[model samples]
Target: MAILVLGLALWVGAHLFKRIAPGMRARMTERMGNGSKGIFAIALALSVVLMVISYQRAAFVNVYVPPSWTVHLVDLFMILAIALFGLGSSKSNLRGKLRHPQLSGFALWAGLHLTVNGDLASVVLFGTLFVWAFVEMAVINASEPRPTPYTGGSTVGTIRLLVISLVLYAIITAVHAWLGVWPFPG
Candidate 1:
């Protein structure tokens, strides 16, 4: 629990720093030059390690038994979450319209996972991500009032979106198999 909490704090704190202390982040970036990316990469790597360890430790504690249907819902939501994430990240028609599609995808993914996972670690991890996504989205929306409208839907963009979404879905499915956690249990 300590590891999970600390990891969440580090991950969320790093993200929130930009929103909470924009000036500080700007000053640091200016001081660090391109090294800011290195700092961020290190922070991200550390957060992932902490999260994995925390989640492993948390598996010992059984908080609640989730309903079976929750898994199905999670699976469905996860697909949408992936599609939205790809659309958000890719140079697609959805990008300019949503202003923060990645954040929205994070919210959806975290919220969906929370519904399926009823454990202390799951709650902490998913809840923190959900809250962070909401806060980040709100901050971004406030900072950028008007969204830059997309020009027009492109056939190439649509194809790219579909291909990326399918590839990611396949990769996640493979990862699930490798981890021996069949999200969609037979």
Candidate 2:
């Protein structure tokens, strides 16, 4: 649990460093030049590894038992979450509609996980990430001006995005099932 918390803290700190301490981040970036991104990437990778390892080993101390019905909801909402996740990078028209679609998707992913996982470890892990995504959104929204909406994506692009999102979601479900957690309620 301690390691999990540490991992979560590292994840949050690495992400928020630039927003929380602009001067310090600037100084580091100035010194490291292009390598600064590598540094952050390494930190994020390490944090994820730590969190994954710790979470797998964590004892299942129940916090609350989610109703079985949420299983179906998780599947449905996850499709939306996955689509929102791809919106930022996809050629879909909705790409420009949201300033932080990726973060919004990440938060949605984390929050949705909580509906099915009620253990303390799951709460701490997903809950912290959920909050961090919102905090990140707030910080970025404050620092940047609202973006102009784009008007140029074709319906084909959106259809392509949906297809890709659905495929990725299917793959993700397969991975979870391989790990012994089937997402769909039997």
Candidate 3:
């Protein structure tokens, strides 16, 4: 559990460094010269790996049990989360409307996961992330409002994003099952 917490701190801390301390992050990037992004990426990957191992090995203590019916909400939230994530990260018209779609997706993912998973570790992991995402979005929007009006988003783009999101969702759910937890149990 300690390791898991440490890993989470590292991963989320680095990712949110710019949001929290833009000057510090910028200074560090300049000091690192050309390898800054690469160095941070490697560190972030390592932190994520550590988190996975620590989380999987940690003991699960029951904190609260969410109703089983919330599993349906989890499924819905997970799919939309994935869709928004894909659209947000892609160079599509959707980005016009959802300036921070990826962060929004992550917030949704964490919030929805909390509905289904009531373990202390899950709460510690997902809950913090949920709060962090919202904070990041609010801070960013307040500082940097979207300049361009949304006009390019189209039905065709929406359809493509939907298909891609669905496919990714299927793959991710299968990976979850492979990891030994079937979210949508048969």
Candidate 4:
């Protein structure tokens, strides 16, 4: 639980650093030069590792029992979340129309996970991310506004992104057995 909390804090803090403390980030960037990306990547990767390990090891304390219907809702929400996340990077029409699709997708992922799993570990894990996404979106949008709406994306790009997202979703679903937490409520 301690490791999980620490990981969550580090993950959120590292991500929010640039948004919350622009001057500090700039100074770090100046010091690190091109190495900032690698440092951030390492910190993020370690944070995830710590979170996964600690979460799996920690004792589960039931906060509430989720209804059976929420399993179906989780599936539905995961698809939308995956689509938004995967398509956010593509030159698709939806990308142009949406602001902060990736962050919204991540929030959806975390929020939906919380809906189905009402445990202390799950709450700490997903809830932190849920809040971070909103704060990150606000800070980023305020700091760097999109000067122009991307209006040149094609239908083909949209289709490609959806197909890719579906494929990626399928792969992750298949790997759930290895992860030991099947989203399906069987």
Candidate 5:
């Protein structure tokens, strides 16, 4: 639990640093030059490792039992979540529809996981991340100007996005199954 909490804090702090403390982030960037990106990447990766390890090891303390229907909903929405996650990089027409598709997808992912995972550890991990995504979005919106929506994306791009998302989603499901957490409810 200690490690999980620490990881969560680090993850949130690292993500919020640039938005919350521009001056400090600028100073660190100046000092490290190109290394700043690598440092941030390492920190983020370490946080993920810590969270995963600690979460798996955490004792199962039941929080609240979720309705069985939520499992089906989670499965369905997960496809949309996965598509939104890759929207930023894809040339999909829907890319311009959202200002923060990736973050939105991340929030969706966390929320979906929370629906099925009623354990204290799962709640803490996913809830913290879900809150962090919203906070990050708010901070970015406050600090940044309105974005120009992307345009000129074709139907081909949209098809590509859906295809890639489906492939990636399948892989993710397989990985979860291999890890002893089958995503689909039997």
Candidate 6:
């Protein structure tokens, strides 16, 4: 739990650094020059590794048993979450309208997972992500200079986004068994 908490703190803190201390980020970027991205990559990798290890260690503690219905609901939510994430990355009107579709998608994903899994590990992982996403969204909205106009995209782009998201979701679902947490358990 200590490692998990520390990982979450580092991950969330690094992400929120820009929002909390914009000047500090600028200073680091100036000092590191092009190496800032490398430093960020290393931090991200370390956070992920720590999170995974901590989650696995903490999984032995069960906080609450989730209802069976929640599994089905979570599947539906995950589909929507994936679609939102896809659209968020694409050059679609969603980016302009939402201004932070990725963050919204992340929040949706974390929230949905929490609904399905009532455990200490799940709570620590998903809850932290939920909070981070909310803070990130707020920061992004506040940082935007002005409301950008939405630009409509072609039907092809919309279809492509849907297809990509569905494919990615399917791939992840397939690998869930290997991850030892099947999202769809029969």
Among these predictions, the greatest TM-score belongs to 5
The TM-scores, one per candidate, come to 0.89, 0.96, 0.90, 0.94, 0.98, 0.92
lDDT of 6 by residue, 65-182 (tens): 8888998898878887887877756865455667667788889999998998788988989999998999888887787675655587666777787788889889989888788878
What C-alpha lDDT values do all the predictions have?
Answer: 0.79, 0.93, 0.83, 0.87, 0.93, 0.82
Candidate 6 residue-pair clash tally: 0
Lowest lDDT sum, 10 consecutive residues, model 3, at 86-95
Ranking by TM-score: 5, 2, 4, 6, 3, 1
Q: Write the per-residue lDDT of candidate 4 for residues 72-125, one digit (tens) a residue.
A: 998877888988887668878787777888899999999999999889999999
Q: In angstroms, how far off is 63's CA in candidate 3?
A: 0.4
Q: What is candidate 3's lDDT per residue for 1-186, written digit by digit as tens? A: 888788888877777777778888788888987677787798789888877888788788999999989999898778889987777655566667877888989999999999999998888888888987888788888777667755666777888888888999999999999999998946
Q: Can you write out model 5's per-residue Cα lDDT over 126-165, one digit (the tens) per residue? A: 9999999999999999999988899868789999999998
Model 4 bad stretches (over 4 Å): none
Task: List, residue by residue over 74-129, the lDDT tens digit for candidate 1.
Answer: 87778778877777656666566676677778899999888878887888888889
**Better model by lDDT, 3 or 5?**
5
Q: Residue 180 lDDT in model 6? A: 80
Q: The CA-based lDDT of model 1 is what?
A: 0.79
Segments in model 2 whose C-alpha atoms lie over 4 Å from true places:
none
Q: What is the lDDT of residue 41 in candidate 3?
A: 91
- Separately for all candidates shown, the number of backbone clashes (residues 3 or more apart, or on different chains) is 0, 0, 0, 0, 0, 0
RMSD of each: 1.9, 1.0, 1.8, 1.3, 0.8, 1.6
lDDT of each residue in 1-186, candidate 2, tens digit only: 999999998899999999889999999899999899899999999999999999999999999999999998999999999999989888887788888999999999999999999999999999999999999999988987878776678778999999999999999999999988989988
**Candidate 5: segments with Cα more than 4 A from true spot:** none
RMSD of 6: 1.6
What local lDDT does model 3 show for residue 168?
92
Which 10 successive residues of model 1 have the least lDDT summed? 88-97
